[model samples]
Target: MAPIINGRLLFNQLPNGLPVPGKTTVYDASETIDLETAPLNGGILVKILVLSADIYIISRMRDSSVEGRSSPFLLNQPIDNYGVGLVLRSEHSSFKQGDHIYGMLPFQQYIVMPPATAERFTVLSNDAGIPWSAYVGVCGMPGQTAHHGWREFSKAKVGETVFVTSGAGPVGATVIQMAKAEGLKVIASAGSDEKVAFIKSLGADVAFNYKTEDTREILAREGPIDVYWDGVGGEALEAAIDAASVGARFIECGMISVFTGEPYHVKISFNIVTKELKISGFIVTSLHQAHLSHFYETFPKLVKEGKIKYKEDVTQGLERAGHAIVDVITGRNKGKSVILVGEE
Candidate 1:
């Protein structure tokens, strides 16, 4: 077979703020590979089909000496995120040709899965027949984050009110639905009226545009928040802390405002002691071994039955990946941002 374009996005430089496409990150299209003849070396050859643009990836774009959720991205290397891909060829027992793999795959059109790093990639059973794109978005890591984050952190009784920050995101939207499903009142916020409407459509009982509304006033009016689904950190977190009910549980799933700058001062730090507020944060991957299978089995069925609403904002091409990731970082994406690198 003829050689093919192996366009890959690289961490060209460390970002000072939100990364600029083609500047801090380099989209290299000059690379090419003969997929039919590429050596697998006891691993797999995969056509990168779908890539998720997640906020978590932004934290990894930093100095190697700096701490992050994972290792910092090495300069000139293909940066990666959670994605589902199609295996074109495989030299492993657990995977075979035509199997779809899910893991932290690089932002490339094609990738060689050398055995050394292939340990992280797992075959997507896809038993529910959910769209492969969903496997990278609502049914993927973000969903697991919401499901387990809610299940583990939320111990509120029925009729409780939970305020979900960054409420229009993949994780927040899912949390909103789950809270409503369990008979809890959902108060969530987004960056725009459109996003506020989207979360309301998912049954958020009280949805607000945090960008325009006074975060503190609104949470105070509608809450004594029984649970704070804290995806947004910084000032929003400060507001949530003030609005929290005595003994409120704070579920820390993400702190995305690191890109937006840290505006949090914890002036009400005394509440943690006086109110007995329970604040807990979890790295979703650490909890997935016991819970991800339940998410994989149940969330897709809920989405399919229209019982749990979900959405995917699919960017059309790999060339747009850098922009797609920027959208996630800046809260510009309308739904779960996914870069469609190839036909699923």
Candidate 2:
């Protein structure tokens, strides 16, 4: 039997802050995957197509898993997040060869799992008229996060003022457009001048480079925001708190500001009390599961009708996965960070 060659990025050590070059090592697995072997009953084999590189994955790489944080990445193993793939073989009734799917897959070229494990993945619809990469980006976790954050947490009403941080990135871009589609006035912040223009192009009523301009000044000029869809936490969060309306809603999403072990102190606890604000933090996975039906029913249609737009920044080649992950964490990618591991 011929040995199946698999290349993967192995977690080398706990990142002290940002992932250093040597923190992860790329290597071909010693154990060869046997393609000729039949899968166990209720199991499937898949060839990974696209992989997601996200900041949340970085938070999990620290030595001790924060008490309330997601499961930490196992040391000396392939870093697992999500990916889009095609079924190569299956022993499960629900899945078969050539079926397109997306789910929490490891950063590897291929995977094999049991039925219970397969339940985490969803088979894609061919009629969706969207690209396979969309399943891992806009139509996938980031889209769901944007929708759920606004619908459930922000509960933003039409004609209200809304603010978003990291507005050029995937989740933030979606939030900006969604807020506009819902008739809310949007003020967004990004790290660079180009990102600011990109956010504005996405229909943000006002967009500014938070790195250059003061977030507080921007919000004050676009004052009394009713909802703050926070992506970059730290000073952005503080500015949101300061600029919040009396009964504003704060939808806490990513905290890229502190992803690298930096400290963030929101010196405005008094405002939370005095302003009678509603602040909520969420994990997109739980929200996605809770609202899977609605998301599948509506989000795709929106994408099809041109009501929703998404962008993907794809880095080609499996060998570049380590650099891709670093780029995403450090805000080097322009849109949703994705790695093309295989042909679509």
Clashes of each: 0, 0
Task: Give the backbone clash total of model 1.
Answer: 0
List model 1 lDDT by residue over 1-344, tens digit each: 99988989899998878899998788888999998999999989989889999998888998999976688999999898888889898898778899998999999989888887777887887776778888877788998999988888799689999999888999999999899989999999999998999998999889999878898888878888989998878888888888888999999888888566655555668988888999998998988987888888798888778887777788987778889988998889989998998874
Off by over 4 Å in 2: 29-31, 38-41, 64-66
- Pairs that clash in candidate 1: none
Per-residue CA lDDT of model 2 for 1-344, tens digit only, reads 67578777777788777776555545456656777684566789888999888878877786655665677777888888878988988998989899998889888887887889997789988476878888877888888888887888877788999998888888899999989988999999887887787898889999988778888888888888999998878888898899999999999998887875468886877999989999999988768666877888888878888788877788886678788788888888888888888884
Worst 10 residues of 2 by lDDT: 22-31
TM-score of 2: 0.95
- The alpha-carbon lDDT assigned to residue 222 of candidate 1 equals 87
**What's the distance in Å from true for residue 322, model 1?**
0.9
**Candidates' lDDT values, in order?**
0.87, 0.83
Which structure among the candidates has the greatest lDDT? Answer: 1
